[model samples]
Target chain A: MMHPSAGGVLKPACYAKPLLRPFGLAWIVMMSVAATTQAAPEALAQVDPPTADHSQFEPLQQDFASGREVTRACLECHTEAGKQVRASIHWRWEYRHPQTGQLLGKQHVVNSFCNNVTTNLGRCTACHAGYGWDGPDFDFSDDSRVDCLVCHDTTGTYEKAPKRGGRVLQEPVKVHGHPLQPPDLGKVARNVGPTSSETCGSCHFFGGGGNGSKHGDLDTSLLDPPPALDVHMSDAGAGLECSDCHVERAHQIAGSRYQVTARDRKGTGAPGQRRYAATCASCHGIEPHPLGSDPAALYQGAKLNAHVDRIACQTCHIPAMARGGVATKTWWDWSKAGRLDADGNPVKRHDADGNLTYWTRWGEIEWGEDLEPDYRWFDGTMRYTLPDQTIDPSAPVPINRFAGHHGDPAARIWPFKMMRGKQPYDPVKDRLVYMQLFGKTEQAYWQGLEWQPAIASAMEAAGLPFSGEVSFTETRMAWPITHMVAPAEDALACGECHARDGRMAELTGFYLPGRDSDPALDRWAQLALAAALLAIGLHIGLRILFHRRRRHTE
Target chain B: MTRTVVMFTGLERLWHWSQALLIILLLMTGFEVHGSYSLLGFGTAATLHVLAALALIVVWIFAIFWHLATGEWRQYRPTTRGLAAVVRFYLYGMFRGESHPFNPRPKRKHNPLQAASYLLFGVVISPLLWITGLLYLGIDLWSAPADLPLAPIALIHVAAAYGAALFLLVHGYMITTGRTPTAHLKTMITGREEIEEASQREQQPERG
Candidate 1:
């Protein structure tokens, strides 16, 4: 429960103690709040309170040397736990998008980060749920393979060693000249309980190789955010768990970054209550403003509702994300990677916020905080370029392209974090290659330092013929910002949208009164009004002259 | 002999002033909605504009029924017999101390210019303003297609506004051109005007 403090102080020693659980009486209030927003992981759907402690059980009483050995003993009591984990998307790294039919997930899609996990399973599977998926021969049907402790471990000591085929290291080793401690498997096995934010945030908060590298909205700051930082996640405020709105059933979480809810034709559940869609509209209807308060309410409600036909809820609600003071990765230039320091070791540099700004193994990097999102109409669909798909070598490739614009009826303008990366791509074959990133053989990019053989071996394993020609291609990807929702009072003011140079000026296509003006129409209207006034002037002059003439004649 | 001529009924004066007040209110709020000037926020301005327009329409309906039921529509009937003289009087004859050529009667009250101006105001400008305003409100409320060209509709509506504005300007001067500067205004308030006995008896109005 020691979600590292938002002040950038990460202390593993502080996390060993168990936090105050959503205890006896407050547990009810926390459950009621879960219907809308509650970050307490125990508030997740269908979660049951434990009847007996695992430490008291004879199965977990024995000392275990490996996580797999611990898993075998736990299966004797909880027979169905490992089977449920195997069926989750967390196990199967591929998901078929319901709307686009595009097969995407950590396995099927090719992103600028670590490219693909094909040849890098040793290091990448540190985040994977099952063991021995190093070369895709791992059995999906094995129930004993799922690591239930990854999510269920209440003990703070469970740590998986990177580059070990997803196994917890049983021995201490040095990593980049730093001493490492092996996780105590026997202690972790005895302490299994309902998941907490710390357990889920373990892999999620440090994605894309470092803290706040992949997802802009998530970072160490969310561990213990304030109401001003994130109203929903702040333990001081709503204290919502990620699984509350992203309600999980069995093991499949409701929300996905791969597929999102752009517009909710189905309005909110109830006033001030939450739904399980992980969307603002799941809690607040399109008509967010109260009606019948004034005569304008009807027109205002309709006007705001009309905007929902093309703009997303996050466009206004999450004005700027990554505001929790932890900087997110904004740019990555892989072309500059592989630069050695004075001692010929891998050079690594950090930014002011302690984010990885540069690394000899990766590239020149940029990190930023409180960033404004790039607004685009996204109808909840993203077109991804798969590992084997043909790419256009003539232009920069988009790892994932956001869809929709003004005229698209079903599309809504959503806010996104546009990340730019320079990665290796096959020029002659027009495809991206997965290098043997962590292997110690001559084909590994890190150990062998040979790009040609490394890519050839990777492409051969992926069932694609390599052209032997490689080029560093600039790539772009957009991640939508749907978190760090500000309070309603902090939402964009009218002048922000309706001014001469408004925030939505270029993004929105309409004749906004204050923002856009038709000079031709304006000129004509002004002339006609002037003519009417001029006619009145002529009438007065004529009347005065006639009156004076009459007086003279008399 | 004491002579008095009934110029306006109390209901007619009430309708005239109330309609004027409503139009003025509509104009104030309507311009703000158009972003021309800000008297109130757009949301409030647009609501007030629609409400005032609706009230004006209701008042117009009552006035129309009163004219038809009471046979007061006959007073606005035009004749070409003295049309040129009336025009000339407004132009130059008034400077030469000449009398108005047309005589007033209950059944045939307005001169050709007055009848023509009122006809255009009621049939053309008023109708155009009402149609466009309603169409705009309908579009805003999603009752009509949102893609309708609001620029042209607004242009026509604003033009009609100018027409009403012109009527107000000229009407202001005409009231002062009566027997005295305040004569027409006083008659509108009291429903009577002093006139020669012959003119008053020449026409006996069939009162409703």
Candidate 2:
């Protein structure tokens, strides 16, 4: 019942306490003036009063030595929690696509950003939900390995140590010249509650090495986003949590990019009726717009609603991705890696905006903000080009291809963040090469700054034949941009897609008025108009000349 | 001797002006929707274009019923009587200040040439515009074969619109060739015009 800041309101030490939680609440209350004025009691009712405070529990009183030990303590009360977490895609990191029958997920797919997570498990596993996933031999069956605090910690201080197999930093350490203190395990364990946007954003937001670098629509800005940034998540709007739409049941989230639901023909569900699908149509009906008295407004709304059959709501609503301040990585050139200055030390260069544009360990990087996404017709199925798949070196390889055509009934035009990169591939073998980019091994690219040795070692580790020929092959990966939905007023105007050289210019197969025109027909129409004008001009000249002659003769 | 005579009824004048306004509005908005140039935005222009088309339809319905009920539909009946002479008068004699090949009457106002042209407008141009416009506006409601492209339908619609535009330009010029430059314009507004007293007496008994 006590406010966290009530003890020392003016004390400097009180400032050190996490301001993220209480500051988020204060910002929500301040931003939602309309809500407060309309229904103060309803706004207060939504504040989730905690039912059971873990601070009074006997088991959490003792300081925990490791994340596994805390997980052991959590198992005493929530017996099936560990089993549920372990069975999830977050823990297994592997998914066999039902349609394609290809082994996918972080464990298999060769991404354009960091390549594969095989040799880079030590570092990439920092985002893993379990402990000690540094190697492929890690036990997936062990229930105690599930790091419950990562998702449940309400203190906002729990962090998994990077490159240490998902372990918590047991001692104070300096990272990238910034001092970080080890989380007080006892305090975090005692304050455990439901998962928050912060908990999910900790790993998801920081994907592809940094915040807002991977998914253009997701970032730390969403923690307390203004309504203009995202009406669904913002306080003044729906104020929905991540789980509210993701709809996690038994720790298996409902929505995923791997198997997208491009079109929801079922429309809106009944109030309080549970649905497994997480689609815009599931909540807001297929025809979400209201028909009003004004015919023009009604036409606009109706036209927009009818577009749901072939166009996604996000296509117009999320006009631009990475909108709130964080710039997403658009391009990465791994071919430019291993560049060094006159000195032997690793080189790094920052851009005018202080963004790391180049680094010896990675390569040249390009960042983009408030960028319009490339659109394509997607029908829920995505087939990836596996490592063993033969690729044409002459053409840019699509790392993952979205499946659909304009004729497909289920297909709809969806926006995507197209990540382009030039990564190493085995030219002779015609396969994408995986390299060990992390760890202390001599073959590691980060440690040795060499690609040949790194690729050879990784290929050997994965039991793939190395052709000893490395070439930079251009690759493209598409991540669907569906979040950061703007308010209705901010949605794209009709002219955005209905004019010449508009947003759908690249998309072919169907005719769109105001955009598509038959050149021959247009030319003929102009000629006909000119001919009519010529006839009229001649007739007028004759009439005027004849009248003058008659008057003179008279 | 010149005498003023009733050329058009008040309802006829109203119909003519309203139809002209609706056609002009439709043409401007339709071209904008065709991406020619922007005046009102595409959404607004498209909406206005549809509304104007609907207005044109209502006006046409009332005009058609009025023509049929008042037995004035005979005015536009195609007849070869003096048709060739009326064509010749416009082609050569009009430049020489020769007399017109046909005379106007209360019950029969159009010349042979005018009647033939109006017949073409009614049977071909008007039908083309109405059918194509309706099809273009209600395309979504057509649940026909998916392969049926809208390009052909749109092409016909645009072509009909161009035909209407040509008619407008010629009609504007023709009205100036009346007794005076503004004679037809004034008569359309006031529903009356100066005529020869002999021609008035000749046509008066038929008006009864």
Candidate 3:
């Protein structure tokens, strides 16, 4: 089948033609015969053929014109960008602000390219103008200043239409003030893979206080061999992004809501919440603190290690909701209330000299006797005894010091009998004296086991008639105050009772009656005064120093 | 009979030039990433390195499709007898300046050594670099579970990077071992090489 041409040239077309001879000849003959046969027939027959509507189709030229119009509409929305001029830090290139009393060219506030002007300069117009601005003078007052091509160029041509065409057909309005750039759009779309991070770093790493502009200290290179900073990027296997830690600044300007929130709540929350969107808790959880407990307990216990037991997990690790107003103190203020009585009721009593008395009881008798007949005291001691047991002559004798006045007067008694195997109890023949005083009445008498005036007085104070045989075992003086008690008297009034050789003289040496009278309030007042004086002094000194420095500099 | 031209198009030359430049750049930058060399001075090196790597990726995507559609992939298929002869020629005969056993043709352009190297580079080395580089990029985006260790992944990435560097050094040396000792280099630059008629049609058997 191969046809040999001159100079060893084999004809490919001629070789293939021979293979198709049978089919080709049959096709030609059938076509000729069918044409002649059909020519004389169907002269009298009428038929209707179907047709399609073409009204809906638009010309390609119309579509192209509309696309151009869409671009113009975008420019209209972003007017400042249309003039090809912006009021950015790049243009100002200075270090200080004329207004606002702020340093103009400071590293934190200035853009990378322009130290004098803020990042809000117009250089960003080329990259960030979402819509094209259309105005004679490029007035910012006009809303249609955003250019779609600035950020939508997937073909890498800055001013041309996007290579992928659906961009213009989508919502074309400038919904927000500034349109997000390409890197931002990529992130939102999630269309690109890990390489998208490089797009973000292109601008984020440069300008302002970012890594790029600080003397090339910030690396913007993404495709290079793995960099140390790669560990910080989302693609570097660490899953971090520029936006993970930084938020809000757009076109190098830091006046967005993110900046406001970050500055306003500084030092008030956890690291993750303070920096990012508070979404870190979704992954980290309330790690350091216990969960589902009162947050106030945490703040209260923050200073004391023991207090931490009551804190919840979210308190320290995550942002905890304050129980009360944030400014309110978490600690209880004891100065707001007076001392409580035996049943935790508020005490309201006065002595004969009209001095307020505060007291609580253990069981029956009053413990803190005021030495005034009308004053009531509640004692907090219980008394018990083992009877028929004698004390050795050498051992010290035990006594019920405040039997009738402070505690249950009718003390419980149990008889003691010497067992054969137990130790022997030899009774010593010695005179025993029991003193029972209730409300300044002293009753002391000694009898073998018979009725004694002291015992009778105790029974009477205890509200029991003297009928049973009584023997003493052990008696204790009861003082029921567990927590510190605050008296109603002010610091000045304390001297009336606490003077030398006065009613408080017996307890003065060890007690320092005046000090104990209102310790907490007095200490608090002294501290407050000292703090105020120190603060005033510091303020005055600093002011003087500042004024002197200013004068010297001037 | 189809006549094969010795000259290549400008686009083909551009692609080859860009690909070679990017591969060298990627290798150097990649080595620095492993803390191997101090060249490119870490920060600058890294930036340029990543940029070069990205350019390489773009170039590779286009080059691979071009090679396949143009039927140029046949050049990379390893042929045992052809490859052994090419190897022996380079190891022994090349030293004596003996004539090469195989000649360049449009359908069969690569020598056996070229075929093997290209296969290894395209199929093994390139994919390994890509996977490791991408993994290193997003390590923090999603951390492995607390129980899983990160050392293995890091090891794989680092190992592949070193392997690529080694391959690059060898490839650079091989490019110099052509006819006239600089013929391959010149061909890459001008996209043309002389072919001897006797060696053109001795089709070598397939290699591993």
Candidate 4:
């Protein structure tokens, strides 16, 4: 027998006593079944089930017109959540590096993909956690603008209109030939729960304008990865979501690219301990290999454990990035953009693999599937090339210089998805020029197909000087390869890095036994060995001749 | 008159043959680890090399104890006496079909030159190889002392490996210098060697 009082839902005032018991019992049973089917076992284990039946809440039950209206109602209960989120990097899009004191984040850094976010605020802010960030004057202190449902909505229908400054549209609209239907705001608000990979990936997975373009390690495939692709996040494996590793506290997420945990010696924390890092060591610990009872396994384990100090786990574990049937944008040539057909319309080209190779406005893009990552020595800190910073045009400029070397004790050899590009730079100023790549205005590069107006307008908006002359300069950005980790059995074999022309061949300042050898030493050793063999052969030859001569004389 | 004498004990022959097998295994695996040629693959070569080295160390421990306990250590106590004659015989007299300047007996198995070379290999080369090999294997256990990085250790280990190879090659050739080409090998295998009766009569009882 079900107790009517035990039901989470409140009995409506108009319901009669007889109807109340059955209705409450039926509602409870329906919710229980829904919860059982909706949440994965691992997700339920990590996150507590929602205690509040939000459908019964008076404010959420209303027909919400705007996202702000829903946020206001959410603030009525989660008062401090708004303030906490408003101060987060997701909202501010700014992070002042602790070591270098250089301000970086999505807001300040100019990426090769689409350049700066300044003139393309409406398009870029669609991913931002806040609302109404269409211009520089958008209020940062306004708590009501902080989006609660974006990260917390269990209703998968929640979506921000791409060009509407992170606002959920009330009316249906079409942009980029894809239909953008308005989400049921009341249902989304009422069903708000813990964030999952789907929620976090709604923005992150689609960064750099399209899916799997910005980060090779992150893609839509990670939403439901298989064991071979990512053992931790796979449904058949740990089934861990983004928040399981990128733990959040008071709206502040743990992981950041600006300051990476390149080498973690902290090891796995004790049970119930708060973790603030998404490093492999934080979960796998220092000794990750299995120390078997047998001798051979013990030897392998010890030898592998020895490498933990110098090599980051991802160097071997990840094997390759963009491995889940999604090709990552590896090369971008903005110089090749601005191509128009005979009709003066923008041109688009697709490759044999159905990948977009060229778009008139965006330029040529080279895709890579299951690509090997470039290795580098990294010690967490990354110094960015700020918009105002000058650069020498002699070589490819690094977008963010990794602050580490072979001599640095804290540094380890890390794997990175190297995104190489050729973008416009001011010849006179010797600095990278920002372009208004998106907008409806005639000055926008996508609309006008003119570089001068776009660069000038974006530079003016960013309060930076842009020389009239522009020249394309090669640039490189290194995104640390830390996700899509393969299983242990699929780790790199010894021969992969131990050969003469192997993965570590380009690495200098250190010596690897099979890969490196001193030519002079080798030549001398060979000579000495040959000499010894020759002397032994000559001595034996002389002895045989002497014995034969003596026998003939006798 | 030539007569067969007990030149090597059972334990000494066991140690010699087993040590030879271990060294051969070590050489094959060691060169592969140095990236000379990949026969058994690097991982397998490295593992086998360590296993052979460990086995060699165990054999050495037993051989050292046997040598000390039976007073056989005196055979390798290097002496200057007859050392010049032995050196000169190998350099000039051997090619001229001259008889060996040094004779082998039950108590004194090695010539002066052989004693000195064996002493150098036993005390210096062998110890160096073992210590460096262990250090290489136990690299995870200790932080290398200042001024001594892993490169030098690996280099020294390689150099010592070359020394071991040379020792094996020279030792192989030197065994052929016996009265018959296979005489020394036969003696090591059978624990007996044909020697002059007068030299055997002159042998004193061994003392530790």
For candidate 2, write residues A1-554 as lDDT tens digits.
11222121111111111111222234222323323233322333245456788999999999898888899999999999888988789998888888889888888888888898888888999989989899879999998999999998889888778778898987778766667678988999999987878999989998987889999999989989887798877765556667666777788877888889999887545544566666877655677665545666666556666678889889998999999999999999999999989987788998887778999998999999999999999998888887788999799999999778777989999999999989999999899978899989889999998899999988888888889889899989999988999877788887788888889998988878888888888889889989989988898899999899879999
User: What TM-score should be assigned to candidate 1?
Assistant: 0.75
Instruction: Name model 1 segments beyond 4 Å from true.
Output: A1-58, A169-183, A267-276, A283-289, A292-310, A339-351, A393-396, A405-409, A441-443, A446-454, A498-500, A507-519, A530-554, B1-208
Query: How many clashes (backbone atoms < 3 Å, residues ≥3 apart in a chain or on different chains) does model 2 have?
Result: 0
lDDT (10s digit) by residue, model 1, range A7-30: 121112221111213322233233
Clash pairs, candidate 1, are A36-A274, A38-A240, A38-A241, A39-A239, A39-A240, A39-A241, A122-A163, A311-A413
Best by TM-score: 2
Report RMSD for candidate 2: 7.1
Candidate 2, residue A81: the lDDT equals 87
TM-score of chain B of each: 0.86, 0.88, 0.82, 0.89
Candidates, DockQ: 0.26, 0.52, 0.00, 0.45
Q: Distance (Å) between predicted and true CA of A11, model 4?
A: 49
Identify the runs in model 3 with alpha carbons over 4 angstroms from their true place.
Answer: A1-554, B1-4, B141-150, B199-208
lDDT score of residue A280 within candidate 3: 21
Q: Give the TM-score ranking, best first.
A: 2, 4, 1, 3
lDDT of each: 0.71, 0.81, 0.35, 0.81
Mark the regions of model 4 whose C-alpha exceeds 4 Å error after superposition: A1-48, A169-180, A539-554, B80-101, B144-147, B199-208
Better of 2 and 4 by DockQ: 2
